[model samples]
Target: MNRFDTDLIIAGGGLAGATLALALARVVPSLRVTVVETFPLSADALPEHYQPSYDARSTALAWGSRLIFEELGLWPRLSEHATPIRQIHVSDRGHFGATRLNAGDHGQEALGYVADNRWMGLCLMRELLETGVQWQAPAEVVDMTPETEGVRVALKRGTETWSLSAQCLVVADGGRSGLREALGFQTRNHSYGQNALIANVSTGESHRFTAFERFTDAGPMALLPHGTTTRAGHQSALVWTLTDEALDEVLALSDPQKCQRLQERFGWRLGRFTRIGECSHYPLKLTTVDEAVRPGVALVGNAAHALHPVAGQGFNLALRGLMTLVEQLRQAVEQGQSLGDLQVLGRYQRLHRQDWQQTVQFSDSLIRIFGDAPAPVAAARDAGLVGLDLLPGAKRWFARKAMGLGGRRAVISKPGVARREPAGHE
Candidate 1:
């Protein structure tokens, strides 16, 4: 038998990595876990762009994700900063078609919640500290070696070099996962020839807890409800997709000038777009790893798949997959099975395969179908929206997919109660 320093080691202390530790700590109390992070855990110690939590961006948490957070006892802190999405309005600009999805339609409290990355991180950070998981921050993973029963991780912290071993290694690093690449994982990437510009914008009329997704010639533009500004007025986080030919010109515009351009594209849905925050842009791509696990190594979050932001499904899909992974690990521990065993990791990959494939197809198809500018395509898009609105069954299906409540869900019976494991883990 081989002994390891820790039961599991999670690389990348971003949202996925940190959340994985916290979730496992709650369910698998005896398992020793450690997290390796490159950024400082202290929020005040880093700039907005550098901070893992304050990446000048916001995330739309599906209703299912909220349940996962609630089960982990992190929702109370997060809800304080989250803006509920009571309704979602989707349309195509200059088209006579639109659709609306309300929380009342599905018996959910709200369709979903929108939270800034910084505050959400703060909430997760609080829970992370309580978990007592070992943390190695301001540190980078220099190299990793996968053995028959465990993995050896090399860390470079300033002038010091440290080595650690874990029974199982989880690579939750971001899309450009250095650790994953070092471990010989293959990734397929397809560039969409588009760029996403994100920022917070103040509007003339109140957002009324409504989110908007408007399709434009440039691309899909989304404005999600954000919390109130210091002045007590409404704000919305903007995610505008544009072509590469327009990226340079758009990013070069002044705040007010950018707001004007946004108004011209988005129309008077929220009346006039007033104040705008600092803008950030990133190229769009569809990235998927060929394999999510091998023997002692398991991949999670963006390291496994990075999808287009068109449907706001990236984080939601990742969260669902994380829940499945946590459940499998808990089952392994209860059955006295090795966490690093190929059987245990292979089950997780099989369970998550369907959800992964569906989400990627949904996001990729939206980009390709909407990106083409033609009369027939425009007519088809308009008809789809109109049909979706008129058909209750179709509308419910669409709402379920958008709200992340369509598939099988992991249940949390009550606070402090161990979840019952599903059968078939032998």
Candidate 2:
């Protein structure tokens, strides 16, 4: 085994891991940090079909996440491919629409933006160059053993094995975290028994920079606008949840058939949903670990909790968790990374309860409220939305929470991120 040394060793290079690396670079510049990513980087952009159709399952970035990206200077690169979500229309199926949210309510341009994950992934890699962090892709942590002094991780790359010892470790290795499991953390999972049907399409009429969330018997059918000027014409990404049985039927349809089927469900709302790219299916569920903290190691992101996509916050909270940990570690650097001991872990636990649990509970409640076909449940939820419109204070709180600004530390939205006109447009 080859011996390696670093102040911190982060396993997994997905959004959570990447965020942790960048946050550390910014907040604790002198700390030695290295990321071990399983997925190797590729030079090719994989020419995608973006004609009238593109299968882009985009993310609805909250103000907080946007702020994080901006502070890290990753926003400029990603802004080119992202579109702002101006207005949000929320209602139950058919004429009984209950509540709608306008950015004017919050004195903001839009609640968030929608951008493709793959595009953002590339932007992350581009931003890393300036972050000055070391990364090992196509790598894995085969074994990890912890001692009072620190933690040691055995990394594997093909046939080579390297042993890395660090004073602190971050576990962001996704829902099925080997380290978390081995360290005695157990997760409680709740499944919605529904899958999200995602795709991108052209709109007949302009989307007017509006995003929509329409709850139905099956689940929510959301439309997030991609208001990009370089990409002329109105475009929107779809996240349509379906019953397990309906999911099978939708997934079985051919690409062309899917576009038509989606148009039928949407009723020409976006100009007949003319085209589609690759249709992907993912089941919705919640995986939360009650014990996410231990000595020398603390889990972040999906490793700590994996939530449903109804609110598109699964990754957002992960980003927030990493950011919080970075801030805590950065400030307590005199105490060293591992010195973030149990007390520091307590801080992380507290923030997780406030920031992440909110989204998980909100999304879970939505899945339960909308997933049920029972008449009483539907009626009750409808009334809830109706009541929300009448309750301004409640709506304001809801908007603030959704924007990821409710946390005590403003975990995700740190107030420094300012809106800038995206390139290729203004």
Candidate 3:
């Protein structure tokens, strides 16, 4: 009989979980893997919006992340729905500080890309169906026991209960992961006293594939280009941050009133904010676990570190972490080492520490520097922006970080693997 039910059991079937599964399947074709998710994974089983990853919010995929997807052969499906960002415009509102980063300056085709979260989820779900990894949805890990050899998982699905064992368990659940908490993992929390208001908007002018990040005393607001609207005008995804009171006030406003407020804040750069689709709000906080790995378990994605949306670093960082983990896991498997051994997982942890620290610190710094309204801090931040614009080398460094470059990289695909370009790319 087999020593375990599967070689790896991933809890949470979101992007990180699914991507890890796909990567593992490619690296270790013989590796047995299973994904357990609480939300409906089947398209016909639930309303489209009801999918766990179906939030209206969009993800700004760093250029490096795009490469990872391409290496995994999932980029072709995602590229169709992605909107490329050729340039980024950073400015401090009501201040004389601004900077712009262009893809051409870095010899790249795009600075980054913006993709609808719902579309990404659907694409990932479709890929999961075609993969060799086992998929179980509307299911959850009710209990897990860590041992020297492996982790035993007790999953609950509807009225049925199943017991399984895995050499390693990966937790990719979101910020409020019950399984993570149940395992007694402690987290450090920093609430920003702010909320992000997100929505799709139609602007009077074309976006021209430019992304704008304007920092105000209230908070930082971003208008990410989402390609053209049905009316042939420009459309952008709005991510506006506000304090608690302002968030409440904005949420209570009518559509036209909200548009007017957005216009006042964003100015006439994109002309007028003519229309806005359904709006959603998410509380902003930075949460990080005390440790991301145990003897038989590891944490990935938000389960490891839930970052502020500032700079759009959360998901990109998670992808980097996932890649590192997979690389380390591959080493363990090749060396015939036990996957659940702390020594094996420890290597993975050590390799990922720098990347995690740098990303977390970078994200937190942006939130601290821009989310506050203190006079001295605001002035200093504005001057910093001015300095960044003046220094080409510094600007390139910042852009590279934003593009998810630097640091140690994991091998995503075979050295000479080629991929198909998605439709709509110029």
Candidate 4:
């Protein structure tokens, strides 16, 4: 038998990594977990309370994700700042086709919720302070080596460097993860030849808790209802897709000029764009790794896969994958198996591969089918949108997929509850 310093070591303390740490603490209390992050994790390092910023970046949490956080007992806090997406209106610019999905029709409170990234991180960190998980932050994993028993990782904090061994290593780093490349994980990248300009815009009319997805000859754009502590009705987070040349031109325009351009593209919907906040842009691409796990290593979150934002499935998909990994780890503990056992890790990959494939296909197809289509294809898609509105079953299926409930979901037991082992394990 071999002994390891820590049962699991997670690199990256962002949303995915922190959520994984909390899940492990709840499901397998006895497992020793350590999280290494480049950012500071001390109490003094985090804000005492969240202050809404006009330009603060945000993420869309599908309905399934709300349930996951509820199980973790963090949803109550997360909800305080989250704006429910009561309805979603999708349309093709310059076409007569449009469709709407109402939460009431589906018997759900909201299809999803939009939350500020900083606030969500704060909520997770506050809860994690009470857990026994160890944290090494204001630090990073400088090097890693696969050993017979586990993985040996070297950490760098300030000018000091030290080594530690863990039975398993989980990488939750962002999309541009240097550690993943260092570990020799081959990736497939498909550049969409476009960039997304993200910002917060205020409208003359209230957003009314509605999200919008509009497609045009140039690209697809999404406007998710966003609210701040001081103002809760007229603001929305905008994700506007544009070509490389267009992106540079838009970024160079004055604030008023930018608003005018947005209004022209988006049309009279939401009245006129009254104001636009600071804007930032990133190149759009589809990045994936065929295999996200090894004997003692696993990748979660953006490190594992990064998809187009057209569907807002990036974080939601990553959350589901992490929860599934947690379920697999729980089973390994009950069976007296090594935490890094390849059989255990392989099962997690196999179970989640389907969801990954479906989501990637869904997002990619949306870009290809609707983005810069010819007259005939555009006409067909517009007609299809109208048909979708009239077909209840098809609309329902589309709604479910958008809400992140179309695939297998991992059942995570709440704190103090006994989790049943997955079936067929006997």
* Strongest candidate by lDDT: 4
The reply for model 1, stretches above 4 Å from the true place, is 43-56, 229-233, 412-426
lDDT of 4 by residue, 1-426 (tens): 447888899999999999999989877888899999998766664776677999999999998888788878899999999999989999999988888999888878889999999888888888888898999987888778889868898899999999889889998888999999988999999999999999999999888899999998899999999994334499999999999999999999999999999999998779989899999999999999999999889989999999999999999999999999998998888898877889999999999899999999989998998887778988899898999899999999889888888766688765467665332111
lDDT of each: 0.83, 0.72, 0.82, 0.89
TM-score of the candidate numbered 1?
0.92
TM-scores of all predicted structures: 0.92, 0.87, 0.92, 0.96
lDDT of 1 by residue, 308-412 (tens): 898888898988888888878888887888898889999888888888898888778877777756899889888999999999999988888888876555553
Q: What are the per-residue Cα lDDT tens digits for candidate 3 across 99-191?
A: 899999988888889887777777777766676899778899987898659989999998999889899999888788998988888999999
Q: Which ten contiguous residues of candidate 1 have the minimum total lDDT? A: 46-55
TM-score of predicted structure 3: 0.92
RMSD values, in order shown = 4.0, 4.9, 4.1, 2.9
Whole-model lDDT for model 3 versus the true structure? 0.82
How does candidate 4 score on lDDT? 0.89
TM-score pick, better of 3 and 4? 4
Q: Give residue 277's error in model 3 in angstroms.
A: 1.4
- Report the number of the highest-TM-score candidate: 4
